[model samples]
Target: MALLNQTQVTPASFILNGIPGLEDMHIWISIPFCSMYVVAVAGNCGLLYLICFEDSLHRSMYYFLAMLSLTDLVMCTSTIPKTLCIFWFQLKEISFKECLVQLFFIHTFTAMESGVLMLMALDRYVAICYPLRYATILTNPVIVKAGLATFLRAVFLIIPLVFLTKRLPYCRGNIIHHTYCDQLSVAKLSCGNIKANIIYGLIAAFLIGGFDILCIAISYTMILRAVINLSSADARQKAFSTCTAHISAIVFSYSPAFFCFFFNRFGSHVIPPSCHIIVANLYLLLPPTMNPIVYGVKTKQIRDCVLRILSGIKNTKSHSV
Candidate 1:
């Protein structure tokens, strides 16, 4: 048995379940998933193209938005492609190293998104609370630096995850109960001591998540305080309008995130594994699908640019016809 166990050794591939206990509805569920992924990719690409070319949108806010869109794009591309494959093609076997890479990017980009949201919150707070110094405080160079710094932070924070996960010996079954490779999901498959992995994972998650939530809360609270003090109703309304898109974005991105984090970690006792898996997929997939819709529609500048681009394309088609 020892020799058999030694031969089994470290796994090369893992089996991923696509919405367990709901296999009957996999085809039905895939439709919406495919639609959301399509819209998110198109919308984010359009947003990035617009921001790159449009001189008017070359400001700090839009730049951060571009970062957000890019992060969202990476976020979805990491999981959804494989997820669709599982649902549509039944290709559920993922190589172990590839799984670690996926796990790294997913968690890393998630942290990147969180960091970008914090920067966005800071941008809005400054724009609203202190208009004059906004330009001075968040210059173009500064914005670029912030973006790079966020990327670096995500990379540094997630590098440890790769090592920690790889250190574990997976003598147990190589089956993960979720579609995508997550740190927890993959770590749970190891047969050796995983207490350190679990502890480090929780600490990292809360540090990034809790810290950002606190900072965003502070920034928004201050923003609300400032908005409330404005004398004219129109000015106040206009100021508040700028924040609504961001507020919606924050809600769209984080609500499900925290839910899945807590429920997946804690609710295992009460909830069915299938339900937990579904919610995990929902939170992982929701932000990328919803962010572009929220920003592209709610923000006037991006919306107008998108509309103008569409109209130009239409006019060109007409002329060619």
Candidate 2:
């Protein structure tokens, strides 16, 4: 339908901006952005690889970590490459179809991250709140089902926007203010009525991502209560300690995201353009880069596995040399 609409009317392409006022500094700015992208990709990939290859790490928590790594990697890939092109190569033009593709993957993966975080919260809740029944409650098949549900939820909610966006008439010039295609950024460019599109986007975002955040908060609250009820101080400490990794991961993931949300919605006049833009980019890059380190430090099992893997590679290199 969007393609049909595009046949008659639509911009041929859209130009993406890196950081509006910092055009001259794009090359320099891209250096740190590029470094973060590389670290995020490498760190997430290594974590995923560790989870897959290590038998001991094959459990519910690792399962959610795997999902998160995949989602974050996709989100990073969707934006950073094109962003690099704009900054370094000065190639800002992106075709309409390609822009939509980028838009779908970016938003879909972002929502997927929220879904996976919810799953992780549930896993922690079950493990802490029902220790004896944890195995029975979240068996391997059940974990697989949870992951599938996460994937379907993310995809189904965002897929409609693809068609809706495709059908909108684009009379506005093709220059997008940001580095990538997004719902609000794209919808604002339409020549026709955009109330429906904006309304639907808000509904989907809140229904899915908002619901996930609410559930996560509830899950943690229960987990905290359970921890406090334990008789021994050591037991309480241990249980709370176990949650630090998830808590850190959640903070790294959501802090920048919510800041970006507010910065976009309410900071138009208050926050400077460069500050908001930097926060927006960090919202996409910070989680994957920090998640692994948080988990490694907070969860001994992951840290041990990572160390073993690194040591094995080092030994191999020494023998070869």
Number of the top candidate by lDDT? 1
Candidate 2: tens digits of C-alpha lDDT, residues 141-238: 99999999988988999999888998898877777888888777887888889888878887887988799999999999999999989999999999
Off-target runs (Cα >4 Å) in candidate 1 are 1-7, 318-321
Tens digits of per-residue lDDT, candidate 1, 243-271, equal 88888888878887877788767887888
Assess the local accuracy of residue 26 in candidate 2 as a C-alpha lDDT between 0 and 100: 93
223 in model 2: Cα distance from truth in Å?
A: 0.5
Give RMSD (Å) of candidate 1 vs. truth. 1.6
Give lDDT per model, in order. Answer: 0.87, 0.86
Write down the TM-score for model 1: 0.95
Clashes of 1: 0
